[model samples]
Each structure stands twice: as C-alpha cells, then as structure tokens.
Target: MADFTTVVSDAHFLEAPRWHEGRIWFSDFYGLGVSSANEDGSDLRVEAEVPGQPSGLGWLPDGRLLVVSMTDRRVLRREPDGTLVTHGDLSKHAAGPINDMSVDARGRAYVGNFGFDLMGGAPIEPTSLHRVDPDGTVTEVADGLWFPNGSAITPDGVLLVGETFGNRISAFDLTDDGRLTNHRVWASFGPLPTDRSVEVVLPALAVAPDGACLDAEGGFWIADATGSRLLRVVEGGTITDEIETGTPVYACALGGADGRTLYACAAPDFHAEPRKAATEARLLATRVAVPAA
Candidate 1:
C-alpha cells in the first residue's frame, strides 16, 4: 500500500492524465471534457470540452493542445484562439472509439482504439493503431493489437503501447515518416490469453493496463484498471513496485514542481451508466521517488 490523498473528487470518470505546464491535465470520460488542476488538486478548471467525450491528451510543438474525442474517433486540436478544430479524423481507420494516444515531439500522434463495442459487451476485436500527422493525414501504423489503451513515447523515440486486455506492453520503433515498425513484446505479464471473448480476456487478465506515464527513471507507471493498483515497470516486464489504490485506478501521471507526484484517476467502477450517473470518480495523488520526464 502507498500513501495517497484525494485531490479532486467531483469528476464523473477521469482518464488519460498528463502533467504539463505546471498542472495535471486529465480527461473526464463521462464529463465530456478535459480539465487541469494544481499540484494538490486545487484550482480545478475546465480546460476544454468535447461532445464525443475526451480521452487522450498531448501538446504540439507550437503549444497547441491535442485531445482525443473517443466516440467520434477524432483528434481535436485547440488553437491559440481557444477554438476546437478537427486535427484528424480517425473513424475511417479505427475500428472503434479511440482511447489513448502518444504524441511525438514532431507532432505526430499515435492513437489506439477500443476495437470493439465495450459498453455493449461485444466481443473484443483486434484493432490497428493509427498515426495521425499534424496535417490530419491518417495511416495505419500497426494492426492486430488487442484493445490498445494507453501509450507513452520514450525520449529515444520508442513507442510503448499498453494492451489493456492483452496484459502486455508492446513496443515499436518510430520512423522519420511517423510510421511505427519493428514490433516487439516489450513486456508480457503472463501468456497470450487463450480466450478471445472480451468477457474472458478481461477476467483472465492479472493486470489490465489502462493509462500510463513515463518517469525520469526511463520506466513506466501504469494504472491497473481491474487490479486496483499502479505498477512501476522496467524493461522485461519486471514489476519494480506497486501502489495499491483502494479503488480501480484507470489512469496515472507523474508530475509536480519536482515531478515526483503520482496522480491517479480512480472510481468504484468504470461502467458507463453508473459512473456517469454518480460523481464517485476522483483524482488521487501520492509522492513517488521517480520523477516525470
């Protein structure tokens, strides 16, 4: 167990946390918007709103903010004038709602999708991860990913994607053209799930990777959606440490003035109807030794 304090408790459901510009920015999945707050979770403010519900978040080289509109499968960019415009339309290439994204320094966004009807309890489907250029050009970077959820990019340009249902993190090398290649299993908790059904795959998972954040130690802190914990993982899938948050942790970020604060988005459940109906979601924080990049 780790010491944690509640920073914000008024959200419906939060995901995709990013530490930037001296604040913790996150997407309220059911709240249909993006928000930011101070280090201790004070001074909460609505940064932007998306009708389709926002998920991932990133900033371009020009300081423009990019937000993922999940249901609509699009990336919305916030201009300098506070306008929300379509940066990329991923619906054509994505099989389902886009969930999370990792943006490169050059403004290329690699995005993942649910790959199936989650709320509808449809069977889980393998999907492709799309690379969206700053000019709104979309292309399939990799295919046959199992429920790709959260992602992070290393300073060395390796792309690490968390497969929520696959219980593993997949790695890819980024090309100059913003394409992903040379796929390898960066980390595998156990084995490839024999069951193909979402119901079975979900239950069989030991650690359902949700959102992720890179630390200064060149490792990742991952939110375990079903495990009620956060794991600090190094290369080769070694679980270095674990932070046990009593509730289900959907996302995490390492940020603060010193970059040691670990922020988690937690809730009693992630069900669509229940989480949206009640404001049980919260932003929780704890201090860690590893700082954010």
Candidate 2:
C-alpha cells in the first residue's frame, strides 16, 4: 500500500477527476457542483453548480467547461462568463442517469449511463455510449455495454472505456469525424458476467473497474469499486501494480506539476441515499511512477 494523503475531505461522493489547466478538476454528486483545486489541494474553487448532480468533467476545444448533469441526462457547458447552458440533451437516448464522460481534443464527448436503476436495486442491463459532437448532436455510437462508466482517449486516437459490470476495458478507434469504429476489448479481468442482478454479479466480478485514466507508459490506472483499491493495468488485463485504498475508490486521475500524483475519489460505499445524507467522501492522493498520457 502507498502512503495516501487526503486532498479534499468532507466531499459528498467525488467522481470524474481530470487534470486540466494546471489544476485537478472533479465533480461531486451530492455537492451538486464541479470544483478544482491546486496540486496540493490548495486554492479550491467551485467552478460550476449543477442542481441535477454533476458527475463528469471535461473541456471543449475553446476551453469551455463541459459537465454531465446526471439526473436530467443533459450535458451543460459553462461559457467564458461562467453561466451554464445545456450543451447536449441525452434524456431521450439514455435509459437511466448518465454518468462519466471523456472529451477528445476535437471537443467530441463520449458519455455513458447507468443502464438501470442502480440505487433503486433494479437488475443491471446493457446500455449505449453516446457521442456528443461539437454542435451538441447526440448520437448513439455503440451499444450492448454493461454499465459504461469512465473513459479516456489515447494520443493514438483509441478510446478506452471501463464497463463497471462487464469486468473489462473496451477499446474503440475514433474516426476523423469522431465516430467510433473497430470495437474490441482492450483488457478483460474475467469472462463476461452472466448474471444481471447486482447482488449476484458484484460478488463474482474479478475487477469492477469504475473510473480510470491513461498514463504515458500506456498503462491504465483504474479504481476498482468493488475491491476498494486502484489498479495499474496494461494491455490484455495484466495488473502490474495495485494501491489498497482502505475505502471504496470510485474514480482516479494522474496529475501534478510533474504529473506523478495519483488522486482518488473515495468513500465508504456508493449508495445514493447514504452518500447524499453524509459527507464522508474524500479525495485522496499518492505518488506514482508514471505520468499522465
């Protein structure tokens, strides 16, 4: 286990961490906003407020902030003047609440959804991944995903997505127009789960990948929601390193002045009711060998 330090304490379930513009930016589900802080957790600033609950955080090519409003299934864009406006609406396409997202340099956002009423104890179901263009057009680029969650785009144009219930990291090639092609599994922890019930599937999963980020050495640092740890996995499902979080780590990002800091969003559990009523969630950090990609 690495020596972990608290970056931000008393958060209401932090998720979707990103290193951008010399700061660590993230979303707080029950906090109803997005925030950024300095590398050592100083100079904390609330960037945007989304009453629907913010999950994902990204930036457009023009530097406008893009946020995922989970409950309403909409993407909100923060203009230069700091006002939020609907950038894209996924209400019609998404079956459940939309969650994490990854934005490419071209401002194309690849967003994912829960696919089922996770908090309501509904059975897990496959869902689609939507691509939001620069003009805010929502298109279902891929489907049959078991709880698509965190995502990242490599420098070589490969889109890697973590399927929380699928026990695998799926890859896709992005076309010039931002469309996904050549879908394949980048890493598989185990065979595709056969059970749909959360009770049955979660205990059987080899790795429950939740939030992830890419590193310069082609490694993927993933927060294993079920394992209460963060794993450094390479191609073909090989876990090269692991960090025992001692708490449920839902998301992670690699960032710092030198890009060697590994930041994790952690809490006791991911239950909505409990998380919304308390402030036990925290952003923890540790030093790592590799830098961000």
Candidate 3:
C-alpha cells in the first residue's frame, strides 16, 4: 500500500485511465494527446495524438481503441499502427461536449456531455447521454440530464452514468440490441460535505467532474472533481468509502497486476490557465482491496 507514487505530474489536463494489455492507458485533455504507462509508473509511452481533445477512452473487441474527441463532437478509433480514424460523427446528436465514456463487452460505447457552455461562465444547460453502436450509429439514450460526466457499465451490461450537475448517478438497462432503456436514479448526495465547497459556500455537487470505472465487487469508483476525493459506491448507490487526495480528483480507474490498484488522474488547477495555476496536473495512484471484475 505504501509503494504508491506519482506517475506523471505537471500535466496540463488528464483523464480516462484504463488497465489494458498489462498497462495503464489514458487521455491527456489539455495536453491534447493519449498515452500509456506501466503499473509501477515505468515504460511510459505516447499512443496517439488526438487534435480535438480526447476525453473518455475504451477498447474495441479487436484490440483497437476508441476515444471521445470532445471539441469536435466525434468518436475516434485508434488503429494498430497508432493512426486515429473516425468511428462516428456526433455533431448533430450531441447537445454539448462529450466528456467520459464506457464500452461494454460487445463494443458499444455510452457517452455523455457537458450539456452547455460550462467554462464560458454562463448558466448550465441540460446535458444528455448518447449510446454508440458498433456499426457507428449514434442514438440518444437519455435526455434532460444535468451534466453527465463519467460513466460505467456493469458486468451484466447495465449502464451507470454520473450526473455531475445533478449530483447523482443514474442507472439504465442495456437491451440485447444495444438500446438504453429503463432509466432510473441510482444514487445521490446526503447531508455530509467532504471538501469541494469554495468561498464558504458549498458548490452544488451535480457530479461536475469526469472519468469513472466499475469495481470487481459490483461497486463504482467516482472522482469528486471538486471534493478532492474518490468515493466508492455500491450498486444500490451506497457510499462504501471515501479516500482523500491532494488535488481535485477528476478521473479514476483500476490497474496493476491484480486490478486492485486505483489510479486517480488529478490536477491542482484544472480550469485555471496553464501559467497562472499553482500546482501542475498529475496522475496519482493508490491501493484498494477489491479488484475490478
């Protein structure tokens, strides 16, 4: 447990860490790229350069990679030779910038967005969720959502999405033909506040951050972007535990040999301009008991 260390730091913006092919693969948001590294933070490698800002990341059944190109509202596939090609164009389907995503065993990816101009300093809009099929078809899964950030699919293929602006997690049914149905609320906040408030006023926690993953025990690991903590939630939407970090926790995933190590990609100044920020962005790793199944 004590061996955990910082893998990468001073990064511009980082997201989406996944354990694939014996390594940790993720996307660099403000860095405008994708990369991989060993569990021990060695053998670091840059896998691709996505020009439009890559967000959520997933793997196809055939060893290819899928990334959400946030700026342009598109999904891309990384070929074996590290070339990125379009998997689907979501310009008309997405109401806002797509954030994090999760791919099921069948290669269907569920994506969500900001729902409005968040950084523009305007009011928040209703963000929605979309489901992308393997055939490159995009469909609206749910609408009128608060800001959908990180998302995950259960081993049974049930979809769970983090509603950042709503401060709750939503569960959906994934049909056999790749349709999302039976939308329901899975979890929400209670009476306690961790550490996300600012200026003596608690910021409304509607799941405003990004990146999420499922644990082997059927629980979900969520990054409290403003809270500076990682929360473990069960299927019934109970908070099992919460672990604190130095910076605002933006994204998270399970890596390492036993899949028991949780890697959190955090940044001290996430929305701050590069030169004006105090702490540089970083990737932090910690150990956990349960593995991801």
Best by lDDT: 2
lDDT to native, each model: 0.90, 0.94, 0.79
lDDT by residue (tens digit), candidate 3, 46-68? 88898898889998899799999
Worst 10 residues of 2 by lDDT: 188-197
Q: Which model is ahead, 1 or 2, in terms of TM-score? A: 2
Alpha-carbon error at 4 in model 2, in Å? 0.6
Tens-digit per-residue lDDT, 1-293, candidate 1: 88899998978999998998899899999999999989988899999989999999999999999999999999999998888999999888899889899899999999999888889988877889998898999999898888898889998889999999888999999988787889999989867777768767777898888999899888888999889999999879999989899889999989999999999999998899999899989999999997897
lDDT of 2 by residue, 1-293 (tens): 88999999999899999999899999999999899999989999999999999999899989999999999999999999999999999999998999999999989999999999999999999999999988999999999998999899999999999999999999999999888999999999987778789999998889999999999999999999999999999988899999998888999999999999999999999998899999999999999999999
What's model 2's lDDT at 208?
A: 94
Clashing pairs in 3: 115-127, 164-206, 164-207, 164-208, 165-206, 167-206, 216-292, 216-293
User: Hey, what RMSD does candidate 1 come out at?
Assistant: 0.9
RMSD of 3: 3.5
Q: Name the lDDT value of residue 133 in candidate 3.
A: 85
- Give stretches of model 2 more than 4 Å off: none
Residue-pair clash count for candidate 2: 0
- Any runs in candidate 3 off by more than 4 Å, and if so which? 1-4, 190-202, 206-209, 275-279
